[model samples]
Target: MQPEGQAKRLVIVSDAWHPQVNGVVRTLTKLREQMEARGFEVTIISPADYRSAPCPTYPEIRLALTHPLAIRARIEALQPAYVHIATEGPLGIMARRACLKNNWRFTTSFHTRFPEYLRERLPVPLSWSYSFLRRFHNAAEHCLVPTQSIHDELAERGFATLKVWTRGVDRELFRPQPDVDLKLPRPVFLCVGRVAPEKNLESFLSLDLPGTKLIVGDGPDLHELRRKYPNTVFAGKKEGETLARYYAGSDVFVFPSRTDTFGLVLLEAIACGLPVAGYPVPGPKDVVGASGAGVLSDNLQKAALGALEMGRVDPDVRLKGFSWEACADIFESVLTTIGSAKVLKSRKVKSDRVIPAP
Candidate 1:
């Protein structure tokens, strides 16, 4: 056990982590940084710490082949005050089992829409996958969702103790550069995220619109999509200011993924003063919702064209309630409440908004 006066220890067990570049990895990375700054000793247990094999189809993501006993032993050695399982992959499953076997309470977050994603790739029924997911998350003390739409959907599916833990953006990195130019066509329609089937990249690439369609990330389908859509520009995977400039330079940000729980790219795009165009789906619905920061429609072409007309606006007005500080506060509150109710009540109140189950 950790001696008194040591920072409150937090063990975050996730299947998603570097060097994979996706929202889950980004969110968890930021969470650790923010939590540590707030005086928590954050320990991340990922595939890098154990023997792993690449996930089938998605080679970039490695699946841990760790035994439950090994996971339990590691957790015991760490002596964490709280454990948060961030995914439902092999590592997350083993960690969940370890916590349960020891009668330890742990919290979880719903990051990916695996049920919809699996159905897009395989012949798996949504019901079968959701049943498995529902069971996986419901085992926890609370399941944190990114948006109210997702929370409602999961609640309808019978998930209990649900809470809303929204995401944040790095405004300093993704701000607008008025003079920056991609040197592409007049209205460059940009889409930044994994180029996977679940992302529905084809929906945007296949659109009949003006200007260039640019993809700014890499995934399993990068090669195939490149071969199929020769005209579209694939910028591969970009990071830091390079990634932000892609958003800043673009005229309209097009998000075609209907499966994403929350599109971090949407926040990134808006932060860069770029208007968004997307299917009136959960992600866009939640982020763009009456903000006038973007346009959403079933007609992808129409949405893109409409967003292009809106031009650039001050992002500060649209991104009022989003920040890494607030995100960490909500996360810490949940963990503290689950780990020790007294600590949660004693901490400075950054946010009092916790979504309870309907």
Candidate 2:
């Protein structure tokens, strides 16, 4: 239960949630858990609560079919002390409109690089997508980014009030298991994430590496990739202890995406004492650059082979500043600052009111 005097109610609106596993879902889940444990009443508004239709191209993600008025009514009924919009999908757009119409302050987060992702699949130009995104996020009091590199990139693109919000790994769940073994060929190179074009999975699969090349998780390109690469092993979607075991058993974790805002899997793999190899991109550069826990190079094949030489990593030292508790602390601090500013503005308006006519 919340303490007697504090206003701790929080409402989070997001298009990303359960039933579709990804970094955004995982981050929000952990954030909510951490907030609730600290006596905050957290309510998440998602597609699961309303009538929805499958997103075009990506059938796994559902889009809400309701109108903005419906979202406004829900937010009004909740009477939350703080509001956070987590994505820029249909639901997030409606929630943003609701907050604007009601003169309520809300914060947003930049999770995916939609501009680059769209360019990969469609003919949409990067400037057009980035403009829409900039406007969507600039409306919020603050826009939370996953890393400093991402923050800088968005700032250059004209996004305002950008703040860095790092991700964390569950140390207890994802740790080195000495006896666990996948029984695959030695020096197994693994990549765990959605099997989509934006993931750049083909880059890793095409590499002339030794031993096994295993993939975990599923997406639109799973069947086709499985058919094309018969020599590689695809373990499909995994969770909990099973997923942790896969990380611990792997010889090296290979990440190929060049557009990820921040790769949470990097932290997960490192927590399991597994070395990583990826391109010298934003996500990899921020997560593993000069860390000695992973290898980053323009030549991904060379990086993969180099990572094989990294013996064991101490998760305690590598993940010292990453934890759900720290993540929640940053989130709460941002909300508190916004709320405080709102109160001060109201007080100033009251003080400036004319009283001579009365």
Candidate 3:
């Protein structure tokens, strides 16, 4: 229990934030809003607040170039009841180091499958990457995963202290709008994610499905993909009502990524009364779950066509299991477990390992 009128402070250190429209950003934004509504004071430290450089290949993602000492100073000043490291980028690394130096127990979230992502673009072995990631996350009191399948997979890969931290969708904004006129062919199949190789966009692009194929996001592979698949409609990035309208206009939401920890877009698509089409992968497998909101198969082309005829499930009944409020409840529980009576007492720190000022 906390003292009256004194809000419990929670500091979130993430490498991903605004100007970058991705699942991680959306999830954190909603989580912050919901947590604040639940009486927790949330502070976010991200690339948006620091000097940053464009990430290689993925220039849309900005990497924080600030020094570890600067991050240490910021976190120390906050003196948050709990600290959460949300990504494996520079900011997260620095925050982890700061916690170690101060002997502070913090939690981390494994949002991306960096091992598979690196292997797609680099020559490094997956084992090497997983080894590094394991060391990074093992330092935390808890390593939050988005799905049970991912938790099981990481556990097999030697990740410890794993906990399931699911994601949610904004139903009010994403619910179906049968009146929106897309003017495209009937039974349109839509893919709404970064147009990158790791996303396996080519799999969806090369499919022999009927009607028009539309892509609703942009990325490094956009130009090349548009050139290769000239027939596909590239609608660039969308948000709020525009994004929701697109989701409603489409007949099926196609997700091609096999490495995603959880496809937040899946919930959004289903919430818009659109069935999903994807492989029997972790994200879709965990989300669809025989909800009759999606058709998952090894043959994406077949699945796409199958999803076209599938009747739209009532978004309310289908999406009842997901909500930002519920997601935030779990997050606050973790913060309370680490920040409350369990280990809230200050511990003696080693004076020799002091973090220097930048």
Candidate 4:
């Protein structure tokens, strides 16, 4: 009754989804939109509630639905050929088990360097926990990472099936118009993300920098942060065009996560023609190198001064070759190959079995 050939069904599994504001949600959202446009049906399995644009309770963390195993059963009934585990949590663990049970080849993504993020909360050494995380990811046919630098580092650490999957800036939405303005009291310096402990928002506020320091997202630490810096502006959660407008109107973007695998916001800021100033972490280091659109420093004094030099940035350079379509195309090709038997056999360690992951 239908066409001779049709798109394959794909399911993306993650613990952090619609309700959570994060890179995993952002990247998967883009990929889903693109794939659906070309006739593929995409479904997401996540703990986050989808009753609204975002979960209720300002910066709320909705605990996962009771008995995720039941939801996983439903997903299994759907029988998707291509599965992507976007996050490692109960939901993804179940999804991975589903794939393994069915011998269904699935792909995993390197959205967050969880080992590094874990070290921020717990007093654990990341180096020790790195291998376990690698093994968790290497269970999949392929692991998509944002940068070649990370790909190499992961490969060295025994994540054999790593692939580069870069983030793309929404140029049309983020491009500088030079007309719109938010008209803050003085100048508004923004650091947008979950106001959690690991992101290191305190470093920016502690800078003793001039102008109003604005936080544009809500998280667990909101109350504590507001209490510490009463003068700082908290803009709550914004979405779609409003989020872009916030990025465009801001004076500078201050990113402070040394463990961020990729700071997608850095690209958004450059697309909005706003320069950035942040830690010399992987995300900022790689993005700034590509765009020459910002400066990086570990020292608060140096980063603050770099924020001032934000005007000297070249935004166009960063916007140059980044495209979500291109990223999706690359993803599609890899998915095709990952579906093949020859590719899987080639990736085998030649011990006549699957290689032992890190």
lDDT of each: 0.87, 0.88, 0.85, 0.73
Candidates ranked, most accurate by lDDT first: 2, 1, 3, 4
- Candidate 2 TM-score, true structure as reference: 0.93
Which pairs of residues collide in candidate 3? Answer: none
Model 2, span 161-217: residue lDDT tens: 999887898999999998988999988998999999999999999999999999999
Give TM-scores for every candidate, taking all chains together and pairing residue i with residue i. 0.92, 0.93, 0.93, 0.84
Q: List the residue pairs that clash in candidate 1.
A: none
Candidate 1, which segments miss by more than 4 Å at Cα? Answer: 1-7, 336-358
**Which residue pairs show collisions in model 2?**
none
Give the candidate order by descending TM-score.
Answer: 2, 3, 1, 4
lDDT of 3 at 268: 92
> Weakest 10 consecutive residues, lDDT, candidate 1?
349-358
Better of 1 and 4 by lDDT: 1
* Model 4 Cα lDDT, one tens digit per residue, 1-358: 1111223677888777765677777888899999899777788877753232322333354445445466557666664556888877667777777666656688888777877767766788877788767777888888888887788888888887888987787777777766667877545677888787778888788777777788888787888998998889888878779988888777777787677888888888788777788777677877776667877777855775676665734566666667789779878766621233432443435444433223
Model 4 scores worst on lDDT over the 10 consecutive residues at 49-58
Q: Could you list the CA RMSD of all candidates, in the order they appear?
A: 6.1, 4.1, 4.7, 6.6
How many residue pairs clash (N, CA or C atoms closer than 3 angstroms) in each of the candidate models, in the order given? 0, 0, 0, 0
Better of 1 and 2 by TM-score: 2
Runs in model 3 lying further than 4 Å from the true structure: 3-7, 336-358
* Backbone clash total, candidate 1: 0
